[model samples]
Target chain A: MRTKRTNWLATCFLIAGSVFLLFPLYMTFMLSIKDNKEIADSVLAFPKVWRWENFITAAEKVNYWQKFKNSSIITVLTVTFTLFTNSFVAYAIKKKFDHKFFKGLYFYFISAMFVPFPIIMLPVVKLTARLGLDNLYGLILLYIVYGLSFNVLLYVGYLRSLPQELDEAAIVDGASVWQTFWKIIFPLLAPINATVAIITTVWAWNDFLLPLIMLDQESQTTLPLAQFIFQSKFGQDTNLAFASYLMAMAPLLIVYILAQKWIISGVTRGAVK
Target chain B: MKKNNFGIYLLLVLPATILFFIFHTIPAVMGIFYSFTDWNGLKPTYKMVGFINYLNVFKDKDVLDAYLFTFKFAILTTVIVNVVSLCIALALNSNIKLKNFFKGLYFMPYILSMLIVAYIFNYFFANFWIDIMGYLGIEKWMVNPLGNEKGAWLAIVFVTVWQSAAFNTVLYLAGLQTISEDLYEASALDGANKWKEFWGITFPMIAPFFTINMVLSLKGFLQVFDQVLALTGGGPFGVTRSIALLIYKNGFSGNEFAYQSANAVIYFVVIVAISLIQLRYLQKREMNL
Candidate 1:
């Protein structure tokens, strides 16, 4: 009876917390469809005339499709390249753990995790300009490289739990090192790969600062950057800004709702490990 | 054969190494090198000015204020986030209906862009809160928190904890699961009350995760930017500026590139030290357990 009572109390607390957590998102959806007079009259009221056209006008104003394409291309390429590069390096380091050079390299890569991005932000901006990479491709390359520390940490830790005999067995079958990694070991890395891919995807997709500084061209704007620019310009149009914000949030929200279980588990695994 | 094997290993690692070197290593080294010089980013020429920039960082009131505000923000957020998330994790760990739904819902904010989340709450504070307060006859509370100096940092903390607690709750839940059910049953058999069971069993079990959350939270909050940028923009007399935002503004906009580089280096050392100290103390406590 006591346990039942406590359980009821806990459930109530959780329900209240959920309401607080979801309030902003609920408001975003509500205000996205609200017109100026309706919003001015009552911020929380149901819209008398839902402005569905707000999304269309906002989309056109922000050039949503172009920015979406930029964001998608950057995120996809960053996740793909991060998985390949970080895991490949981690694999070699794991295999050669007994060697001093490989061990040192492992520490060398992971130590950068302690170095905040601001330390390197200015120089990287200058270097990217110098290298003619101050664009989307440059941002992708930066994500892959910046991600190396954490991704390698995750990969190396995962790799340590697997047996070395898997590699030896493949080598005995007359496979080269690269072939063994690709055909045998790479297939076994599905879980960590998912974790890495999810992390890199979220980061590259949602990042604003890197793109804000690096991409000088207006055409290179990602969704967040475009929303920022849009908000600064059309911020007074409450309905339009909310519409733009909701549109910025929609793709990720859809993806999260669909693959939430995998994403939660993946993120949890990344954090705890 | 040994030399050939070494070559193969090197070849496999070369691509990532080169990229890491160019992007990560070169910039880090250049940042440090530039700290000793007077390069204003746009200038092609610079002269070595030893220790002056670092000294200026000490004398700059804005930098000092930023450090104070950042540390205050980091400490407050870290403590609140850990406490709230741990409670949420505990509640979720108990027998509950729709556990998966709640878990998914809690983590949803974490996956959204911080800038976007901040914007959402900016509107909330600007409009929703004011409207509700006005309806309640609380005229004093109707002012937007973002525009008020004292309330701005608190608003940032609230938004931060709102989003970040989800991630930490997930971690704490992971920690909670590792506590064996048998242990709980055994403790229950001893007539141990819920409080005793928590302090004696649950707390110690999740201490490692507490450490993880605290360190990560502190480190991340110390470098707070996106939320501050979106919500306050370090405004209302620059009271909410974080060290990261200050560094960016100074380096990029103010043309104090080398000076901010020194600030960044100091910031890096402080972070490293804080993390190391937390890990050592927390791990030692875990050892005693």
Candidate 2:
């Protein structure tokens, strides 16, 4: 009886918490549909005349498709390259975990995690300019390097839990190191790979500063940067600005709604590690 | 075969190592070296100026303001985020139905870009909240906090805590799961109440995660950039500037490349020192627990 009452109370508390959490997003959606004039009158009211055209206007004004493409290409490339490179690095280190060189290398990479981005961002910008990598591909390369240690650590943790005898079986079957890794070990890392990929995609998609510094050309602006510039341009038009913000947020929001399970689990796993 | 294995190791590891070295390692070394020089971004010729930039960092009022604001903001957000998330985690870990739904709802904002979330909240602060508060006769909320120097820092902290509570909740939830239910049952049989049960069973068991969440949030909060940019842009005479924003403004816009590099190095040392101390303190607590 007492437990039931407490559960009911907890449910109410959670409902209230969820409402507070969802309040801003709900406001965003509401404001997106209302024209600027109505925004001042009814902060929480449904629009009498929904300005659905605001989205179209914002989309056209921002060249949303181009920016979306830039965001997509950078995020996809970063996730792909980060996953591939970090896995290899982790696998190599795992294979030779006892070797003095590999041990030192592992420690070196782990220590780098403590070095925050601002510490290195200035020199990185200068170096990018000198190398002529101040573009989308360069942004992708930087993400891979920045993401290495954390993903590699995740891979190493997962690798340790696997039975070493599985790899030995492949080795005894005359499998080359490459063949063994590709055929046996890589396939086993599917779960951790998903976790790494999802987390990296979210990060690279949302990143602003690196893209701001590196991608100097207007044509290469990512969605967040484009939204920033667009908002700055359309500062007074609340409806249009909200519309642009909605458009900037829609892709990830939709993905979260559809794949919340995968995302939540992935985030939980990543954070716990 | 041994030589082939060695070759495989080199081939597998060399790409990431080299890339990380060029981008991450070298830049860190250059950041330290450039701190002692007056190398502006556009300058072709510059000379070293031994600790002058560091001394200036102390003298510069704006830089000092940024540091003070960042440290204050970081401390406040870290404490609030941990408390809110732990409470949510505890509530969700209870026998509530639809807990998954609530968890998902809470974490929804976390997946969206901070830039976007900050912009959304920007509308609320600038217009919506003021109008509503005006109607309700709440005079204080009628003013946009982002336009006020003192209030802007609080606004940033509020948004940060709101977005991050979900993440730390998930972390604490994961930690909560690792704790066996038997301990709670034993405590309950001993006539322990909910508060006692939590203090005795829940808090100590999750000490490691507490440490992790604390350090991660502190590090992240100290380097806050996106939220400030989207919300205030260091407005109201730059009262709410974080160290990262200050570095960017000085290095790129003001052309104080080497000066900002020195500031960054100082900022970096502070971060490393704080992290080391935090880890030592928390880890010792975990061990003691």
- Candidate 2 has a DockQ of 0.64
The TM-score of candidate 1 is 0.97
Work out the TM-score per prediction.
Answer: 0.97, 0.96
Best by lDDT: 1
Flag regions of model 1 displaced more than 4 Å: A1-6, B1-4, B131-142
For model 1, name the residue pairs that clash. none
Give the runs in model 2 whose Cα sits over 4 Å from its true position.
Answer: A1-6, B1-4, B131-142
Query: What tens-digit string does per-residue lDDT give for candidate 1 at A59-130?
Result: 999999999999999999999988887898999998888899999999998888888889999899999999
- Interface RMSD for every prediction, one decimal? 2.8, 2.5
lDDT of 2 at A130: 94
lDDT of 1: 0.89
For the second chain of model 2, what is the TM-score against the true structure's chain B?
A: 0.95
Docking class of 1: medium
Q: How good is model 2 by TM-score? A: 0.96
